[model samples]
Target: MSSDFEGYEQDFAVLTAEITNKIARVPRLPPDEKKQMVANVEKQLEEAKELLEQMDLEVREIPPQSRGMYSNRMRSYKQEMGKLETDFKRSRIAYSDEVRNELLGDDGNSSENQLIKLREERAHLLDNTERLERSSRRLEAGYQIAVETEQIGQEMLENLSHDREKIQRARERLRETDANLGKSSRVLTGMLRR
Candidate 1:
């Protein structure tokens, strides 16, 4: 495979492994450990994203044929990464809800007041989690679309560069013809004056 493909594949593999490790360990982690794990995963995810951005910039510098193939592959990789991030966040929210519920302790049939309070709290958490999920998905989709569009734009720029070269040549020819016409005009004027 091409070096670009190999680099992307390697980065994806590392990201997958890190995410898998975090998910596997999350359930078993104590509160502090869970917090630390989440932080680590977030950091690694950020690094992966930066790497992807750099790759995108490099792809723009490459020729169109290879760049298109690499861009498509990168787009696929980004979609998968987005799904993984969503899953990670969902897992964290579920875990937090479970902890909160355990702390709240459901006593035998609660008084109307207690029941209402618990219901309100649960509803709030649900709303917050839903919002988080929606935002995550939207952001991911927007980012992927931007990357793909940028690749298409770069290809268009390459085509424009070629057109620019042709225009420059045409301009030079026009200038040369104008110079010859100017000389002829000066000679005709001189003859008429004589």
Candidate 2:
């Protein structure tokens, strides 16, 4: 790897490790300190993204023969970044849940109040599930209606086509009759002349 590429790779590795450490520490810290750490990790993640972009540019400049190895390394780095981001997101969610529990005075303990809360949550979930099921049924009914409407439209189009063919045949027969009548009139006129 070129010197600049190596530098970017090293920076990415260091930043990724730092972010991972911060994510691990987030759950253990107080809410105020955790927020600051989360912000710092987010900013580092951005820097890591920029470094990856730089590495991509560098990879493009590399010769094809040696590029495969570097490309694999780049993919591995990206996967690592993805894992880090996922970890950070999970950490943030856990922190938020903790704060919400604290605000609700749950104190991570089970009690009568907790049971009531659980029942309420369960009821809410059941309501949402019923709503979703109703929506699904409506969608299915609509789909069936659309299919039937399409079939009706197809049948109408077929009938119109058949009618058009019948009209064309009628027009052809009318023209033939007109020609025969003209011939018959001419023959009678010749006889009258004679």
Candidate 3:
């Protein structure tokens, strides 16, 4: 890490830290408050993007390697969405079948009745599958959020360990200084040797 790079990094971090913290606060907001918060974030992101583009065009050039970001945990959500959809479909079918039998009687009646009932069941299943798709999408989005949060927490704990080590060293130095304080103070108290 070059000094100049570290200096720029710190400067940029200072500039954006408040905004980053504000973004981090989204999860703490209730669903009722999210619309405004989301709008604010969307505006911020757009403005930031345009400013960055102008910077790249006129002032500082951003390298290709650092240009964009994509979340890796998104793939996990894709996988989970599929599983959630299947689980939802299975549960809905089981529950609906139980309810249908209780209300419409068991399936020992005429063939025409059974056919109509089967068609109705099929339509209901189709509706449920569509609903489940929307639900799974929303659920996976939250799952991805949660996974990212856990990752950030792990990073925070690692930084905390580093801070702990520094604190321990400072404490040790303080003890050593205290032990030698009396000898050092005597020379000062004597005004060079009284």
Top lDDT model: 2
Each prediction's whole-model lDDT (CA): 0.70, 0.77, 0.51
Residue range 18-71, candidate 2, lDDT tens digits? 776677677667889989999999999999999999999999999996566567
Considering TM-score, which of the candidate structures 1 and 3 is the better prediction for this target?
A: 1
Q: Choose 2 or 3, whichever is better by TM-score.
A: 2
TM-score of each: 0.50, 0.55, 0.39
For residues 89-149, could you state the per-residue lDDT of candidate 1 as single tens digits?
7657755755665577745455446755754665565556545645765685577678778
Evaluate model 2: give its TM-score: 0.55
In model 3, the Cα lDDT at residue 162 comes to 100
Supply candidate 2's per-residue lDDT for 7.
97
> What TM-score, to 2 decimals, does candidate 1 have?
0.50
Leading candidate by TM-score: 2
- Of candidate 2, the 10-residue stretch with the lowest lDDT total is 125-134
